[model samples]
Target: MATLFLGLNANAARMDMVDVSNNNGYMSAAEYVSMRNEFGVKAVTVKISEGGTYKDPYAASNIANVQAAGLYVNGYHFARYATKAQAIAEADFAGQTAKAAGLPVGAVLATDVESQEANNQSKATNDRNNAAFMKEIQKFGYRADVYTSGSWANNKMTIKGKTGWIAAYPYVVSGKNWYSSNHAWQWSSTAKFRISYGGFDVSQLNSDYYTAGQKSKVKPTNKAAVKANNQKANKNTSKLVASAKWVKETKTYTLKTAVKLHTGASTSSSVITTLPAGTTVKTDQVIIQGGYRWARQPRFNGYGYLATGPASNTLEYVKSGATHTYYTVKYGDSWWTIAQRNGLSMTTLASQNGKSIYTTIYPGQRLVVR
Candidate 1:
């Protein structure tokens, strides 16, 4: 029994929380780090196990990888119990697995109890087992909850005390549309979008539910660990400031003609990226390559080799009226790559920033992406 969901997302804090299972395909930490930004998620849920001992092999990796990415993490255990004792045992397994897998500071453990096998039992039996699962998981010192279809919750499954993570596809409205109080509504079964390979089930925790879930997760007890997390946040803030400074101290320029930004200092090397005529160029330093002067930077990732002076591209510094501008360079970004990402032509990008595509752009160099 599933209820339809519809309504403007008027309630719930509405933070992006996506759930993934083995069906979503394998994703590594590197992939999660690089692609997680594309989805703008606040939290991620990974399937941990089913029944009493059946574990999802990739659950450990997915949970650990996402937690490492500094996102709020949650784990859900699929239920397949016909009795309270079995439900309790499975609940314990889910809780222990989450702890063993390093499921971040404020992670929730959810009981996914929507299997037809479980539902085949009388509604009375389903209600007892589902409640038992939630209760047992909560006993393990976790912020435990339940996830099910709206119809199941209404007529079949019964979980009254704790929060209910409802999945109501088709009607697919918002958290507020559901009559269930303080519920973390999952409005769809068909994932709305994709991050890497397959789609993911999306849900939102109303502000109250979201905040409560976050607050319940235990904090890192080690002083050093707390300091490390703080340092990561502080480093990002400092990097942002440095990028703003670079924009202030630097003058913007555009390429006057087309030029090849190569992988090495010499033109014989493969082309790293191309700069069409009129591409904005920015560079911190200039180097001589093949008896011709070229703009070079330490952070350009082996790209942006253009002969200096008025011949290949004119070097002119311009100014902007904006309050601030900055773009943090990623691990494998060239000036051309950065320009392409921002939808600007190579010439416009290089010229506006006055940087050569060959500038060695480090992983953290602040460039003006805008």
Candidate 2:
């Protein structure tokens, strides 16, 4: 029930933690520092290995840089095991690979088990194989957890007593609210970060994975100390700086459906007014809270949070006020797609917006298309 701010996951897209198609990418020391200072990142989970073979080339550099930046660095292995033997083999490889990549022992090293082969197996088989993998991973002196989608975590496998990192993105997240209880909740794959040109995968952790892991002089050999540490993590109600960012440029949106504007991000908050359909509202910021995407509209007294639509997208509640005037970027939007939607080339659109085609566009950014 407590809210604990946590860090994010990084793969080929290191500093920004953005997901790119290619398997290799870089994140500089400065970028890691920005992530820690600007975003309240306490730790980062980097991809280390896959199956029994592939080692992420960026893993060593990422671990070294994050540690040098004064943040905990964890690792995860992508699993491709259908049998117990294969799972054990993969775990051995992951353990060695993580060590080679500079992943410190005792830091969390989760096994990513969302592959098609694992999903296709029966629930019992999947659980057995995953348990085998996790047990093997722990022998290398590292904490282990299973990372999988919410559905797979429940139906395809069981995480009854074991630590888990479940992935499930809802329309709105009030704070640490998820479908299934777990050690960590990977709430968004397209989470927008200020320094990033694209969306990044972000998670909320509810464990001592980073906090206790960092401070402890040695691994807690006492079971009581371990239990107490986990309890403390769960009871930690430390307030986190709201990740919502205010945009510099404002844009007008004409409502297609009537919507209640609230005083706060959650719907349960006091309602300020119910703007009728076709109402044109100018908004400067977008917030993801209480399971909805809220547009912050400037009211006479102050600002009101208007529920534009589900967190997934806002196209259903409102549309652009006029043609070729301005457009606010949304998650999953790219320069080319925005240009195509507005009937212009990327170069033309960028030129109109006082940017270049190479410029990075992010959600809540306003672009001129005229």
Candidate 3:
């Protein structure tokens, strides 16, 4: 069959998501499910190697956990070579990494080629090595492909039989532009793939790449025969977790009733805004005080607090990666008192945020709690 790249067609199949990585960090299976469920991610592509030999320290763990989450996975090798000889070696290295990580036959082996550094490589060199990279991986029994940005104009490389994964930032890419078979699109850098301290790069996948469709879609010819097999497989699934850690619903929260924002987690604290019923707010820090639930308004439009009571029943969400929570000084608050109130270390908190333990805090001065 001739090769083709299709974007997400909700009716035809589901819109799948992918993430590429190279040891900046790794997510636990719980972490993966938490983030992926939030965005409906479907698969992940791990960075197995660089050039012909350098390996990603975290690829193995990431692959195992992501697969455990019941997501399809592929492996990729970052190209740094300039010769056919090096290209072939890098391809083999990638295959080894993938197989070692438990990726099976027919998994897509992608080449992440971009213009960021070019690392002083010439176009001729890039094209030659890139083409060879895809070809050799295919020979190793993979569904190989090339990844790049359209702006780089690096389309001169060969991908006639393989897929083209494009990184066209700030655009909602549909894989319709290059070589007539761009199989994947990295739509943006601002979007989060893993919403933790920092997130991973995310992309969308063509159904062809996930047709076997991860575990939840597993199809068996004989249900009676597969039941025993499934029982055995379940015993080995320690590497995966499903859904986000705390996402109860989709992004953008709506208030069920009227609410108020308080300076602190108290109903009697200074009210910043009394949001009417059905008002909207972004999820941020949520705390409990004085028999009520409080949420922080960290954004400009509704920057204040919202409390949970008869008037409002929703609590705010605090991001797990937030470093410090600031507190606006009140008339009687002191450095020591602030630290004591928030359970912060007075000296370390003051110095790190740029202040002194003895510095007199004033009313209205926002200070990082010690």
- Candidate 3's residue-wise lDDT over 136-193, tens digit each? 8887678877776554444335444335776543222321332335566554433333
Model 2 local distance difference test score: 0.67
Model 2: per-residue lDDT, tens digit, 16-50?
Answer: 12221113245556656665665556677888887
Ten consecutive residues with minimal summed lDDT in candidate 3? 1-10
Error of 2 at 23 (Å): 5.1
Give all TM-scores, in the order shown.
0.50, 0.53, 0.49
* Model 1, runs deviating above 4 Å: 1-15, 30-36, 104-106, 171-176, 192-195, 208-370
Ordered list by TM-score, greatest first? 2, 1, 3
Q: Relative to the unseen true structure, what is the C-alpha lDDT of residue 359 in candidate 3, on a scale of 0 to 100?
A: 77
With a 3 Å backbone cut-off (N, CA, C), the pairs that clash in candidate 3 are 33-243, 34-244, 68-240, 261-305, 284-317, 344-370, 345-370
Off by over 4 Å in 3: 1-15, 22-24, 115-125, 153-162, 171-180, 193-195, 210-370
Model 2 residue 314 CA deviation in Å: 22
On the 0 to 100 scale, the lDDT of residue 146 in model 3 is: 79
For 68-175, candidate 1 gives per-residue lDDT tens digits of 776667788888788888887888888787777666544578887765355447789887887787777776666767787665665666646436887654322322
Distance (Å) between predicted and true CA of 47, model 1?
0.5
